[model samples]
Target chain A: MYDARIMPKPAPKKHLSAKEGESAGGRVTVSIHDVASAARVSIATVSRVINNPHLVSARTAARVQEVIRKTGYAPNPFAQGLITRSSRVLGIALPDIHGEFYSELLRGADAEARSLGYHLLVSSEPRREDRGPANGSLAFGLIDGIAVMITDAASNLLKEAKGSLLPTVVLDTDLHAKGVDSLVVDNAGGTREGVNHLLASVPASSLYFVGGPEENFDAQQRASAFRAAVAASGWKPRADQVSFGDYTSEWGERWAEEHLKATGKGVFGVLAGNDEIAIGVMQAASQAGVRIPDQLRLVGFDDTRLATLIRPRLSTVRVPMAEVGAASIRLLVRRIEDREAEITCVHLPTSLVVRESSVPRA
Target chain B: MYDARIMPKPAPKKHLSAKEGESAGGRVTVSIHDVASAARVSIATVSRVINNPHLVSARTAARVQEVIRKTGYAPNPFAQGLITRSSRVLGIALPDIHGEFYSELLRGADAEARSLGYHLLVSSEPRREDRGPANGSLAFGLIDGIAVMITDAASNLLKEAKGSLLPTVVLDTDLHAKGVDSLVVDNAGGTREGVNHLLASVPASSLYFVGGPEENFDAQQRASAFRAAVAASGWKPRADQVSFGDYTSEWGERWAEEHLKATGKGVFGVLAGNDEIAIGVMQAASQAGVRIPDQLRLVGFDDTRLATLIRPRLSTVRVPMAEVGAASIRLLVRRIEDREAEITCVHLPTSLVVRESSVPRA
Candidate 1:
């Protein structure tokens, strides 16, 4: 196991005769030819041994088998696929995999795929500059279906996916593209209800909204709903009340600090983009001697584990990330199995959860 | 764009006659025979259209192109691999994906693999009862290398991995298997230092050790280190002081509650197996009106995000999960490129972080 000098030898390409189009060795990258070369036997003999051992003498077959084991050669899957049309693998395209969001989605998707007798192949946004079908072909060739999640709907990350032409499910973004199924939460409705709850419970002079990145579709939807909710309540909420952050706790803390500094009133409420942002604001509030619920009330979205774990537990709108992931697999698998199946646009519901931070102590 | 009824059509397996196998159709499943059938031409004509398009008549080529577009058919990958030796993909085998730990590891591995021009195919541990090489073959066929993470070293999950004979890097578990590389944190060192810190800083009457599952190698290492540290400090730690729990926050809470109930003294300290467990203990202590660092001091391992978010931030050992993930990829890639590379056992160093929960206030 500790052999330091052993390096994998690269197999040189074989130029086969035009008549047979078969390189003297196997027709694949890890061809039977390499095994034959190591065994000092003809490629035909090796193939005969694997396909029909009876045709080859036992002694010769045994020698070839030893060489195959030493070389670590396996038969090409494309040859086997000729008999079985399915690859039994599914692909998931993530913009990035750093956060809790994508990991939860992955867990749900992996569990579902495994239960369905399939495995998941995950890839981040492809390098758009790579150019051409080759970039998509590597993943496309291995998976029967794919699920793509892109927060920025307009990003070109989906272009290669479109080029793959495999059955696909789009998560989070409402991409109204031909033949693409979508799985999205009711972001606007959830935000609207959460905002309404905050307004009814608090007597704050103004409600400040902390929005996520401008390009994020879900963020845009939540921001729009926030404004709509304020308008419906007959409050002329100022544009200055809204600030943009990157959906991180640090960003939330920075934006909240700026909001507090600019405003003269000591009493106000905040609608954070997500739980991380809310936690950051809470941390900052504690540092600045601003009491939660008493001095500043806050609400958050995506009731992640952080929501419940934080002191003065965050009141948030819960987005069922794992369920969305499971549903995406179910939909994509159906699309793969039934070519004529109708495209699906699934909008799962979200609900507002009341907790300690957003409500005043009795 | 919202049309929901469109389904992906399955590509039927192509069965070529012996005479036609001689045609340039490629002797694999989903061969040129299927394309020729869809194009209403001979398999040779279809092959000519793809390989030597200049030689084919323009009108016939145009008709074949239209048919190919309508059928959504592409050439087989094994045939393509015959020329391109690299698949440009890596496999990551995870025990589970729900926690922040695995997610952080994935983020690091994915970032590294992408930078190295390889995509990642992720899978959970295959069902042991599946009992066949076929269960893992789908991923093995697609990836150039693999990284496996198994907390339980005794698990039979590595059996199929051995069968595939792919280059692999095992994480967390220290299995001294031949040809396989291992990446592990210094669990014993981290825990020993943490326990020593808790003992020296606080005037606690006794120290309690919270252990994770018995099967987990990391948990066992940490527990061993805790006992060693106690003996080194000339303390007669009681056998009843050691308790086992799952690496869950709830379990941590339950065990801490039991410890508190059993002890007559109000002042004590805890060495939790992980941050989650520590956080749970903190919650239980808070409910019991116990003042942190005064009534009880705590130290957790794997200083995850949860450490800083809780009130009286947790003092813990920080495991560099991302760095370990990145290193695992580098080692696996080297092994894949050089089969004779020396098996590596990388022990990443862990640091003890002092925070409010463990440090006494002024």
Candidate 2:
């Protein structure tokens, strides 16, 4: 249904065209034709100059270029693409765009993409059912390269992308395709530090691990690290000490409710999968009169801005989200430029930031 | 310089071409030739079936289409754009890509744009001096419509957009251009509610307003509303009672330091222009040994995710950021489809979310 509030009233009387010299305010833009006329050159010669400068003679091209510059004529990308085969645009597919993490990534990628003389077309990963089978490489002509940030690489979308042979760089998720490049941060390293810090303040037997989605690559890496850290601490985590979360505050809250009721005073420390869950745990703990760092200590991953904003302040793993994003674009652009370049996986580093939430209260 | 990670290594041996069937993964995609061969039709006839079905006989078209469907051949957008002049792509230009506000807006717009069968190309507003005169309207040919979320509408980019004749929608900032449409939340209403809430918790004379950047449209609207609210309360705010910020947490922190050092204890209530500034104020207040709610009452605008995450859970005016974003896309699409459509200004509603930060202690 049309959103009426945002819809403009119909005006059938006036025909609006996107062609040149028909602005609503009567402001006319100079067109290629205007440049051609002013320069006394044919439109084909003008086109040849812009797309293939070497084709035209230096003297004639110079004169045409001067007129083109003076008239401010921008060639249509579509018309240019027919000859150049380069749209000079890149596409990025993310799961969604609401989160701070995704936005920061987009910013980094966009900055890098623009500096490389490319524009970014970003979209949520479309449902497989929504895209017709024939539309597998529909973006082929419109965009030179694509960077897919889908969490689940085994999905039909990724499978289709794999077969499409598009110059693609899979972010975070490990597809391990023969030719596609992959980029990820050192999830396990940061996660290990988070667990180690928690153990330093509390016995391993008293520390719990709150894991994120099972299908998540980062979650898997983090959970593995937590297990290793726990084993290294010479403690076997009880079944009840390990909980699963979907990387959300609500899940964190829900699990916290169960954990607090079951363990009561037994669990003195927790290493959450992410900051959202840790915050949720804090909220639930506060409501239950369990003071952080006094009754309980917690550490989270992905030290997003939320880590510092919460009461008691969350100590967590800091992922350089923007840099990861920039790095992903750099990888994808290289793939686009060199189709046969050896596949490379660049793993950026992550660090731990200790805050009040994970510290013993004075 | 090209980002080293994203740049391809020297490939003297490999010649890269983006033509059909050649994939980086060496996966051969089905092309129009495959459909033509399978359907027993000439390539021109197959192209006609895909691009201009009306020109082909119904029986022949059905045969070609069935083969096309069976083979799963996706027609390229560039090849199609050459004939149809429609890319089904929309461009969104924002001041920057960072921040929860801009991200939420983008999420809304991106979701809506996709649902309407259009992809979104997002870019930061280029520096005015960086863009060539011709580049100003270059997006006109690349995208069907343009939505700019820049705060300063007087920039050269907006001026060039005003005259481009491309269907455009300006968000937040009111360009008031004859042809462009605008969509914004009730900044004044939301700001007033925040201020009124603060005054209710403390004496009107004890309250202060922290404004955002002067060049920001929302900041101006909020500041004007703050002043009006104060005037209505029968109190004239001294010059020291109103401070300006750059809509950043750091600026909020900086201004709060000045306010506290100057007023000491007289200003117990504050209405911040946005959540970032409010968060800054909270940090500064905490550092200065001022307790929230009891010693200082605060209200922030734009009820971003930061509000709930922060200590005391900031009371804020909930700007329907995602909805505003969705509305902007809907408006721009309408304008593009019907250039004769009358201009529209959609002011979405805002509500005050009262949390612990604005409530006085018992």
Candidate 3:
């Protein structure tokens, strides 16, 4: 079907036609000639919208927008080192190869991509430094754009990948890098709220902030927020109260045991790194013969499935994982169909979904 | 890079390529060309071994067998239909659209598919009848083959799909339909062993089965196995000894509560349909002021992640979910690579993994 709907295209280069065997984030050689003929718009109008959007009348813009969305078109394949066009596949590079969260996220992305007549090619890096060719390999062969979720984007491979003039979305990372749209959970906001909920019910000093992997963006934000919240409350919570560990529940248990013993059963509260750690902590506390929220308050982040399934259900910061997945595909696909489509950084909100875990000062 | 190191020209139409893709029960499709090349003999001599075994020495057949193993070539896809060429996409239709098991399975399949240079196209059917055409869409041009978890199969679409010769793997379904390859768990074996383990110290006749969705093949097999085990022990178990319920934790609680009210608070020795049901049963017993194993012993199936995470760690039948995921993809990609590979049902072994849930039955 020839699409007549249009949207404002601001890129100087508007052609995004398919080339044989293109890769992700490559220069999309597809031009406005393709969109105009496919959408029944004049090439001149396409150019006006791409290079100079204000010049196009509102009616023409709307028509173009519909056409782009309908066709599921994408403009850049240069991120994958391909100049030819292939919009059928999206490239997603995840930081961790193992984990239910990333796997589920990709499932959500795959579902949306299929619904929109597209497919996803996922790549993963075993570690931060192993992020280059291993992850960049995702760009191989006709990818319309890139969706990367890695911690250390400063690595040369990620850095080069970042500067490419391709349509891209960054997940769970900083937006300081130019020419990319980032989608991040409100780490600080969620953590701050969680700590507040715990402190409101319990009055205690020397609250523990369990930090995740040192380089992790989410973990870093959460650690800082907990400390800041405690400071704002004018609590004399010891700086030594902060303990570092991975996000695994095992770490939570180990840390809690050590902290509890050192304190000799003194008044204490804990802000765990994530749900996994939170679960471990709760279990360890239970084993150590501690009552939850009554004698000691505990809070966790990333309200994962474990939060509810565990006993004395966890009160955590709910990460909109599925929504993030859905939004990334929506944003990426929209950009693909419209070379001139606006680049947006959509920040999904997080909330403290209180269950029976943490309670007020007893 | 020249794959021509051992390259041979495509054999003529008589190459027996079509024989590779069918049921293993049928004839093996080793063509004269195949055996002749493998034996390094003339086609005329290779033909003699088949038509006139006396004319060709046994030495030649031995050589041909060696080559077959080395090349790992078999013809099953040719026998199946649409064997030689397939879309790079493989379709997996899951019964339910949610849960960690499906998530992990999808990840495993996706990982394997990626390794084999293919991508997965997943579809979720809310109900059994909703399996075909996905949300009423007319086509599945997105994928070349189908993999179903079988709850949504067993309908007209399956009958039609099989006849159409779509390379299909029907998982967890025991239906010996004409063309589909079945991959199923050893449900009966696991349950029998599990019940035996728990019942060895306690009398078998005293035990009960908390069955899953009565329609599920695994659930049915498990219930059957438990009954048979009780019977084989030379004890006639009463019909009132067992309870049937959906394979959910909520049902577990409900059924346990009902059992307590019916039996007047003293029912022991329970085997759950799955871990979820077992968990629910535990909750119910706890609420009723009955302690686990002390007052009532429980056994669960499908040692999902929840098994180890919960208190009084679940004693369950481990389904090997990750292994199944890996195996399905391995088997599937092999089929994709060679249509006429082999056609035998794969039965991955299942076992009982005991932890803290069930205690000695009295």
Rank all candidate structures by their TM-score, best first, as comma-separated numbers.
Answer: 2, 1, 3
List DockQ for all candidates. Answer: 0.30, 0.43, 0.07
In the range A116-186, model 3's lDDT, one tens digit per residue, is 86667565543444333523344433356777775653434355445444567777775635556778778
lDDT tens digits, residues B183-242, model 3?
788888888888787676567656878887776666778888888888878877788766
Give candidates' CA RMSD values in order: 12.3, 10.9, 15.8
Which stretches of candidate 3 lie above 4 Å from their native place?
A1-84, A97-100, A121-139, A151-166, A264-266, A360-362, B1-89, B126-144, B152-166, B175-177, B236-244, B264-267, B360-362
Whose lDDT is greatest here?
Answer: 2
Score chain B of each candidate by TM-score.
0.75, 0.83, 0.70
Model 2 Cα lDDT, one tens digit per residue, B1-362: 76868878556232232333455774345567667767888779999987688999999999998987776677767767877778999988887633787788888888788778788888877655665544542366788888887676455556656655678898886554554698877888887787788877677788888888787777778877888888889988777777776877888889888877766565488888888889889989999888888788889888888788667889888989889889999999999888888888888989999999989766
Residue A37's lDDT in candidate 2: 58
The weakest ten consecutive residues by lDDT in model 2 chain B span: B12-21
TM-scores for all predictions: 0.75, 0.85, 0.71
List model 1 lDDT by residue over A97-137, tens digit each. Answer: 33678788888888788778777887766444643454443
lDDT of 3 at B92: 66
Q: Of the candidates numbered 1 and 2, which has the greater DockQ value?
A: 2
Q: Which ten residues in a row have the lowest lDDT in candidate 1 chain A?
A: A14-23
Pitting candidate 2 against candidate 3, the one with the higher DockQ is 2
Poorly placed runs, candidate 2 (over 4 Å): A1-58, A126-140, A261-267, B1-58, B126-138, B257-267, B286-291
- Go through the candidates in order and give each one's C-alpha lDDT: 0.77, 0.78, 0.68
User: In model 3, what is the error at residue A98, expressed in angstroms?
Assistant: 6.5
